[model samples]
Target: MSEHEGTYRTFTGKTYSLYGINTGTNQYYKVIKKLADLFLQQCPDKKRLLFQIQKASVNRSFFKKRSGKNINHSLISFIKKTLRDSLSVYTAGVKHHLRTLPLSQRFDSTLMTKEEQYHLYMLEIELVNRIYKEPFKSSQYKFALLPHCLRDFRPDCHSVPGDVESVCKECTERCFIHLGSLLLKKYNIHPYISVTMDLEKLFKRLKAEHPSIGALGVACVPELVNGMRICINLDIPPVGVPLDANRCARWMKQACESSFNLKMLEALIK
Candidate 1:
């Protein structure tokens, strides 16, 4: 994956790249590049640069001012052109692009303000999630893939691991246990902790055993995009509910409580 950095051609002769996110440093660029490479590997034949921008810490003026020398004039032009006209027009254009183009070509947020880019990204996620809502609701096997970062980062918040997924032992975080039980008992939605990093394998194995499987992922904006891509590639319809707030240790040091719109979760089941 690291080798995919710095203008590498894909197997299909496409000039794909894992573009840097709001940084001019080589190290940060390389880090985003690796993540983009993993995403591309999951679903090849998608010709576009994966913008590895974190929703919580995105720098809006990344392309506004040149950073040393690694400035991309064309990328700047693309964003400016897309956003220069009318605000409503740009919003509509974003929708059209997301609907028609592949993931990579759908966005070029290099020049947009941080808030604007985050808004566009959220729109894309919302649209994609809604597109899969019906299929997801009808799937035979439904899963609620919860992230470990959503847990309260407490010394006593120990979760028990199982062969398939981790069980949320009623520790410091009651939300996890609450949602897990609610999903299982009421909606018949199996709950899984996403920390094991075996999602692809687990889905593949379960898919082999079951005819159809769908998942409702609870994650931040970036993980939602990655998870949606993988689910689409695997032919598993998925709907996502972004966390109410990004309480991950990286973003918020003190508050580790996991929160989301319970209404949205219930709506998905309904």
Candidate 2:
């Protein structure tokens, strides 16, 4: 396996690795871009496309009922079918993961069904990125919130509190957080380790401080999509790259080291 395809424990025994989804290539991102294009072709309106995807993610039967006169139900059904077949390989563990989910988190928005949380949310991130990438690039002030799991835990982390969240001290070159921070800073985007749990309050404060702000997120799929939605509602153009797997404590009994596609992050920002 490649460094990006290292074997790691998952919530479900089955792996949901995205490392080689495209067969013989590590660029699973191309698959995502292609699928996003297909979805976009079916629903040209970005906002409505996102809304319909989000709806399908939460409820599998969303496409079954008539949504509205303006909505194209037939095209929406086609998109749903394509997502199931194309995205299933990357979401193999979702069903088993949901079966073992804690009762307390059963109703959590992040713990939606396999199709909703895995397939639809994957498309949602791509769509959100397509819609917000240019605005995020042009904003006068830009910042990024990276998941703490991306930090190299072998050494004592030197991350310290920043104006918004904890900032990486770049103590270890092997850490993905350190590597991602370097690239983000090179593009004039401030990078912070996302330690805060109250995102809504944090975003509200940020909007007041930087009116022309844009936000970028590096998180697992469910959290990343929700964060993008929060930013959009607050008028902060947001872009994000999802972690390769959901190996955090919230998903697993103990947090395991995880990585995101660094190349994908640069692509979204640049």
Candidate 3:
């Protein structure tokens, strides 16, 4: 892994923080890619493997059902063993976060995701990027949805409505949304500040307009995986970069500053 000093901050997450693994976030990406390559070697079918990983990651009951299969069992065991000491540091707060999660949000499956699921979700993102990167690049119309939380919290965001979501007005040079927007535009990818709650509806409408559409997302792990799944079901090739930490208001009492790996984002699209 590149030991180059990463721009990762020490910001903590209610459930996970990539910086927890090491001062730099590059190791997280490296580890996930290694694990993904190993898993793919066992099941050459990338789509089928992604499905199995996603299913096992979310429902413990479903995971148990597949335990009879050596591949399934080994995949879970391997991920748990391999990630426990490294990437698991990022998810160390998951148990506490789940215990203290408000009763009102108990039904929110994304908020209720366990530590192991977070680890699996990291692999899922890497796998999806590998599967869709080419299609996403060749897509006639490509766009990225950046979480609004990535905006500079120091100033009032000047984002305005766009064709599908809120558009960054470049109000602040230091804002991640602004910086990311600039990088994405270089690759002809439209970047929007994600504010829409009903992604299914929004994606459906967008798909109708751009049949060869591809999507890229920047969000927390669970949310990023969920969005990628939606795009897949809608026949939109998807790739994503998860936030370095889940420090938004949904995870904390108040939204705190958060960021994603800009270098990783460029690597995915470019």
Q: Count the backbone clashes (under 3 Å) in each candidate.
A: 0, 0, 0
**TM-score of candidate 2 to 2 decimals:** 0.87
Better-scoring candidate (TM-score), 1 or 3: 3
What lDDT does the true structure give each of the candidates? Answer: 0.52, 0.78, 0.85
Reference-based TM-score of each model:
0.55, 0.87, 0.91
**Model 2 clash tally, residue pairs:** 0
Q: Pick the candidate with the highest TM-score.
A: 3
Clashes of 1: 0
Q: What's the CA error at residue 167 for candidate 3, in Å?
A: 0.8
Structural RMSD, model 2: 3.4
| Root-mean-square deviation per candidate | 16.7, 3.4, 2.7
Per-residue CA lDDT of model 3 for 95-212, tens digit only, reads 9988888899999999999888888888889989999999999999999999988873656788889888989988777678888999999999999999989999999999999999
* Cα error, candidate 2, residue 82 (Å): 0.5
Rank candidates by lDDT, best first. Answer: 3, 2, 1
Best by lDDT: 3
